[model samples]
Target: MVKFLKITAAIVILLLLFYFVFFKYRQIQANKILIPATTQTLFKINVDELYKTLAVSYLKHPSQYAGTDKNSIREKIADLNSGLRIPANIYIYALKGTAKNTLFTRLEIADTSAFNHFILKKLALLKKDAHFFESADSTFGLLVNKKTVSIAFNMAKEPIRHILEEIHDQNNMVKISDSKFAQMASLSDHLSFQDAENLSKINFTDGKIDFSSEFENKWIEPAAEPRHRMLNPESTLSFWLNGKIKSDLTEKNHTMSLSLLSKDSFFRFYQDYVDFEWTKTVTQVDTIVGYEYNDDFEQVEKKILRDRKIPSITINLNSDDKAVSNYLKSLGALDQSTGKISSAMIPLYQFYFRGSNGNVQLSTIKSAKPDVKRASSDDFFYFKVDFKKLINQTSIPLIADKLGTFSQLEIKAKSIGKNKIKLESELLFLNKDANALMQVLKVFQNGFKSALDLNLSVDIPVSK
Candidate 1:
């Protein structure tokens, strides 16, 4: 009995040692994939883990897969699994100062030959060299090595090469093992993102999408008063900002609240009331007609229709200096008799305005009044959007249909430590029991079906 007990203890110790060694090896391997310090936004995804999570979610809500070809999707997923390395991570990132259209993606390749064949079968190749290829009308470029594949979208070949070179240089890249974002990302098996100012982690569970971000800088300063109490709870969209932000819109440090009453009213205020000619340049088009007198007489000119939109938002500004209001009044934007503010240079809509206790309220709604509700006292910044109410109030079918998936979105920011702030955002879905990712998949599937139905119903005249 003593010898048996000794053998059992020895086996347990060996297993423990193996686990620690394996974990450390994975950490070292992940650290080898370096990211450039100048990267503006980065997204890390665990491919195999995400697939497993999605599979479980699908089992829980099988109804969401209705009207879709399940076999086709399974086959595609299987093909991807065969080409990429399992239990590894893929990174998608954007660099600072680069165009918004440019993006970079890096993935671990399990089999180089298989991945190369997979790419060739999927994309419409525009050009190809030894190990480099351009596809999708030259908008996408791919560089495949033995163990890794790097892809760049909307980027030239030279720039992609330069970034690849920089990533291999230790001094030019960030140390992934020491990065806070990397540590947070490793905690979750799904997806995580890091940007210049913030590191965020996303989790899908409990029937809602929970996203949390940690700010690198003190973006939200502590407020002197509970300014959140000044916002109306019935507003479709409400935002509160209390910080010293240097912008042309405001000079001094102040607290501001912006509220939108309803989606219908907001759209109407912009489409029918706001004057676009004052700030926007008119787009003109030239057409060729018939030649009556000369070649120049055949030319006809017409202005293109402008579909400009601005939100019907109310602004509440609390500050010691009233320079903003004075400037508007000086420019004839505010009507002293009715206490209304109109468009600059040209009057289109007379927005309601009132001033009391050094607080200014300007809104497009005629019945706008001061109503306050204290939601939180500690949060320096808060934003909320009632998607259900907005959808119910909107006359546009497309906007209503797309936004119907979400019930509400709320975000809050508070100081966590010195020069650090925590921002938490929650998006509530209509189906409270379904997984957030499954709900998102349903949204896309339904949208595609609707588009197909619309196309089929359209009456296209047959060409003679």
Candidate 2:
């Protein structure tokens, strides 16, 4: 027992030592990138890493940027390393004063030796042609220090000098070794300045951005709430949003491409309203139609009509459900009987069956028939959108004819794996070989063909 206890105590001591060492290392690393919030908004971006990532992506898929002159592009990219002294780190701060908001950009240049030369060049150019800053020429000035060059625009020279003095004297400038913004920058290639308060509210991992409730209330709600009730002030939009360009392969099998993924939390409010329940019921009905109850459809339709609390009225001419069509015909919901569906039923059909084969058969309440033909597709998995129907439903005449010119859009997606889906989307033109728009399609097709050819053969020179 004594020997066992001694061994256990030794193990515990080693673990405690390891824990302290790890904690200390993490704290040191965190402190290295901690920056102060000097203004209402502060953004820190690592230009060196950003340029490197872009260069690698461009090398991998040189064909994507085909329209541009290749030699010129190479020269422009090379300039990043050629005596340009591009800042390793960039910070843009927006100072909100009582009178106005002043915007200042600070670049932490890698080499200070070329700083004076660069400033002199800018001053010489400004002297020759002051038209570049004719609007606020007097306010523009370059302040160069040990390793940083700060440029102030749209502000008086005295104020700019005073601000610089404050930064130097009070040490008010946010440092990458001390600010939360810098910590975030260290994790991601780019960061957007939201607010100074509550840095913990902004969480960054991989490429995903997770915001706290305060962030959602401040930024997201105001912009999205007006358009859709699904994204209300009370409703959650997305817990995590990620949009990143990958040069190297990711778990999702993406390389030299852009990927966007978001985790939506709107389903939390699924039971908040009757509309949501009805939507769920409609989805269940669709699933039932697809997988089971082909024979019971007649009984279902009859029961729906008899009950008058119709689950929903849907129009799908491709549907072989004679029972549902017959029931709608009996109620004058479909135009099959009298060559027109009633206007009273139009709104309900529009609400339930969003996308249909052609123009939504709409008529006045007093009108007996609709002039438009009813069409539908039999593909259960494929979604066909008729732009003409959408435009007619909105009744925006000015754009109606223009929108009607667009043919049907088909979108289909199939899950290829547990976390991957292959989406095939296409827009079909109504005019086939005759429309002038076909020429535009040909141009795009030719360009894509050229790009594919280049992708197979062309080699892009990547800078170190």
Candidate 3:
């Protein structure tokens, strides 16, 4: 009887102790990575947080970048403090996502150089030393690898092709077999007959596209330039796309490659929005995030409980997982998705983009009817976009969920036909739960409104 009482008392004490160490106290993830030979200690920062900082940057500046040298731009990161003797131990990694926008007034009135010129400007700003930074040499800046993609509308213009040939100074371009009508069909169909039919009005009659494009050479980081040995120059990554409707989109399988001016830019893109873009090009993704720590789980668990107050604890070596589950349940990130925030990847075992697509179909059914004049027999729907910007300002819940789940996800994408297409996000899970996965998908389909219909707000899932 005495032994039983003693055992009960010990169990109760241990339970209380566990709560104080894990739930009540803050937690941090500690992992291992190979760094410069000069480093004394290395810290594994959360990839999700770092990416949020970047999402915020591009979201805030919608015009895109014009130069590569962004020293002033680097100084603008609000979260990253100035004058650091060394880099912080907290390194966020793998920031990635795609924002949808419309093409307005093509550069040549007919030539669409938005992807080449405008996108370059935005990317240049993102890779600038001031933005992709570290507190010091050993301060440890994460190579934030991000990809910026935009599909141009006026791709059908013959003159636009000629101008591109002139710009590249090469006439060896091969023609892509995809048809214009098929390409445009996948985008928003709000392009009224007046817009789609009047192709002649938007095309450049001249053999050249006479539009101004800004370029900045400062995109190359001098220090990170020499360290390009990690990633292979020629490697293909795969992606999965998800939407309410199943697609037969072949061209969407091929992704546009952007070779950066510097190695730092490459890593920066990877860190900022890794597989977020690469993996979402084909179907849905079911992610699994497993921890890889330097020490054994049992020993680390004890020490983690001892030091819970100073930093914070995520579900990892120290986590039993039950505490995290309870925490997430209270936060309402479990089965019931609240909205965009509900789509976010948070805590351990979170979900993203599983909710349903808010689909809106636009069609010119009346015009194509037999009685109508000059009616063509192709499907008549193109997306219409009325929004502030294609991309958001910070790390959204969906993006945060993506970075938290996978270490190096390979995201790939290409433009789907004429539609101003907004592909759905992929799923990132800490573990595999097919049932919860299905429920999340239903939520997304019901909650998320199609970006084609209206203006949307930027959802910063983690900060709030």
lDDT of 2 by residue, 1-464 (tens): 99999999999999989966864554444334323245666655545444445445456545534444455544544433322344455555665551135556644455554544444453332432321221235566544556555555645333555554444343565655554454444444433354544332222221122332112211111111111112111111111111121213223332321110111111211111111111101221111122334565643322221222222222222222344344445665555533444435443322322213322222122222222231222211234455544554454565453444444555443323332333344554443332222222323443433212122121222222
lDDT of 1 by residue, 1-464 (tens): 99999999999999989966875566456646766677677778765456556567668765544334334555655655437674456667787767655777666788877777778775645546676777655668777778876777865433565554344333466655555446644555467877767777887763588888887753334554434545556667777765543233332443222222233222222210110011111222222334334466664554454443334556655532155456556666667786665544223334567655445566555465544334546777788888776765556776665667778899987767766778899998877655676666556653432211111111222222
Best TM-score goes to which candidate?
A: 1
lDDT of 3 at 368: 14
The models' CA-based lDDT, in order, is: 0.58, 0.37, 0.24
lDDT at position 34, candidate 1: 69
What lDDT score goes with residue 167 in model 2?
Answer: 42
Error of 2 at 446 (Å): 24
Give candidate 1's root-mean-square deviation (CA, Å).
12.2
Each model's TM-score, in the order given?
Answer: 0.63, 0.36, 0.14
Off by over 4 Å in 2: 1-37, 66-71, 77-84, 96-100, 108-140, 145-147, 153-158, 168-170, 174-185, 197-464
Which clashing pairs does model 1 show?
A: none
Return whichever of 2 and 3 wins on lDDT: 2
What is the C-alpha lDDT profile of model 3 across 259-283, one tens digit per residue?
Answer: 2212332232221111111111122
Looking at model 1, which ten-residue stretch has the lowest summed lDDT? 271-280
